[model samples]
Target: MTWAAVSARRLARHRLDAPATVGGDPVTRRIADVVAGTCGAHAQVMSAAEVSVAMRVAGAVRGDVRNALWRDRTLVRAHGPRGTVHLMASRELPAWVGALGGLDADRGVAVGEPYLDPDQVAALAEACPGVLAYRDLTATELTQALADTVGGWAAEPVVDAFRDHLPRWRWAQPTLGHRGALCFGPNRGREVTFTSPARLLPGFVPMDGPPALRRLALRYLHGYGPATPAEFARWLGAPRDRCEEVFRELGDSVERVTVAGAGPAFQIAGDPTHHELPRGVRLLPYFDVFGVGCHPRSLLFAGGAARRALARGQAGNYPLLLVDGQVAGVWHQALRGRRLRVTVEPLVRLSEAESDELAFQVQRLAGIQGAEEAEVETGRVTVGPHA
Candidate 1:
């Protein structure tokens, strides 16, 4: 078969392998399967933070709270993948984080924007002792508490300013609801709302060196398999050679398949089943890995179409509505009276049937996210629990 047909088939298979895919197993095993099945039995790695959060949410053997550091002995950490952090299995860190360059300068892409400069970060570390709960510490409280150690820097406004570097900042609250909301929780209303990094860092699985690289390649390949080195590099924010190295290491473990409609793609030896076209719509979170993973997103959407929709910042900044496995529109949600209202913004004009079909999908998403009901408005769609 021609490459396009081969790629299309691979794309279909990829849709089948995605985590939390619809109609899949409904057990903790499914979650574990998502992490393990994507790579292999030996490939159970995730960011320490991501793992901690995942475990807390999943209610693994330990209680939801995490500790200050995952590995108590290590003073230095080998963060991996895109210069950000991941909780790889202990065995995976040396090969993953150690192989790549350390502490990337492009904090926005890697470490994130509001990253604390050395002094400030150090101050944060030192202040951890005085910190009671993760509740939002006013910059003043943080500043006064750390004044001796941090020197002249003012702490109050600095805290607010820090937000520019770290948009996800929130004081750990005493209630579980606060903590869950800060992170992505399956359902709402738990206790221990405010959280500190300490509460979620231990679960970090650090993978360093070549093993890290190989694991990343395997994850990307399995999750987005049937892709080329270029595609993998773009998603990884790394070089093509690095991507190829990982693929080479795996060798025959990954099955290389050429797609017909989609061109060339790859797939794991055995993936779970998937749905046919019109599989249903998904409202993906902003900066969702899917969007950033594949640059020149035409690989998934219509060619030249992704950049236009994504460039808008506002529309591109929020959760997206994916219809039929393609990012067809953008959506937002707000609570209204007794229901949730959802606004849908289509990148392209839609026919009457298409609009109606999209509205139905938005309603479903609202229900899943805990809205009582849903309403759709024109121009832009907003999803809320009230009318």
Candidate 2:
């Protein structure tokens, strides 16, 4: 297939280098629309999730995100791509559940056996909905209920499991919600609880696996396109063979493109070509979709920026500082009473204009966090506890 050559700057511009101001039919009015834009916003770090949404939507407060998740039910918190906690649009639960939950079977006994014997996992899957049906219950409460329903084995916690992996339940909890059985309820202090999506959402309809995965892949390419199957697989945390199957399924709907230095990539057919390099500095929160979604890290975090911005190869360890759409450095914020101190550690010496832009970005970050005032300092600073 012939590939259309494109520049890295153009690719970055197309991906919303200035993410705070994404252009399209403005859906910032609805939280679901914002979440759907990036497919899903990372919520593994709650503060990061709040900042991610707040930055995208005009006049949006952190409480708005909280209300959307807990009160309005417009967004659902669940294990999404890469088996990480993400805030997905409630209406898209069916597609997300189908796409992500289907991976459980593909993972096979090798992954599942270590957590719980296949039989135990099966039993818990069968009993999970009932245990969490009408009431929002905590992890402890759910474990006890599962134990009561399935047996003591259901309460056993798995070793080396990521976030709240005890009881060895399936990754996509929204899958249960898609069955009209369970949804995340408001937290009781620091403890999260679950109830029924049917009761909470009222009009959610579950989509089947094939269509759901297809829709997800298309949306992903649309938002972070000119991307590769390996990038897709890495983002979804699914087997590469399965991801390639989806790519083949896309076929004529997506056209191949050549990104400068990054080789071949794919984008939705008929999407307009962009060549403008967005001008500005942006302070992206930890796990911000734009930073975490793209692949070929060497291109995005080129030169010494990668070494300074990332701890090892992990992306979310620190908030990112972007200049002209490339990772330039890392930043951290310290709150002292009403004043927010944002310290930036740039890997490269920035121009005076860029430093001014950084100051503006710091003020924006302070506003997102609802700080009364912000102080921008250029120096090396330690990563905060949030990491």
* RMSD of each predicted structure: 9.8, 3.6
Evaluate model 1: give its lDDT.
0.42
C-alpha lDDT of candidate 2 relative to the true structure: 0.73
lDDT of 2 by residue, 199-239 (tens): 56666566777778888999898777778988999998888
The alpha-carbon deviation from the true structure for residue 182 of candidate 2, after best TM-score superposition, in angstroms, is 4.8
Candidate 1 residue 198 Cα shift, in angstroms, is 8.0
TM-score of 1: 0.54
- Candidate number of the best lDDT: 2
Q: Count the backbone clashes (under 3 Å) in each candidate.
A: 85, 0
> Residue 267 error for model 1, in Å?
4.6
| TM-scores, each model vs. reference | 0.54, 0.88
Instruction: Give all candidates' CA lDDT scores.
Output: 0.42, 0.73
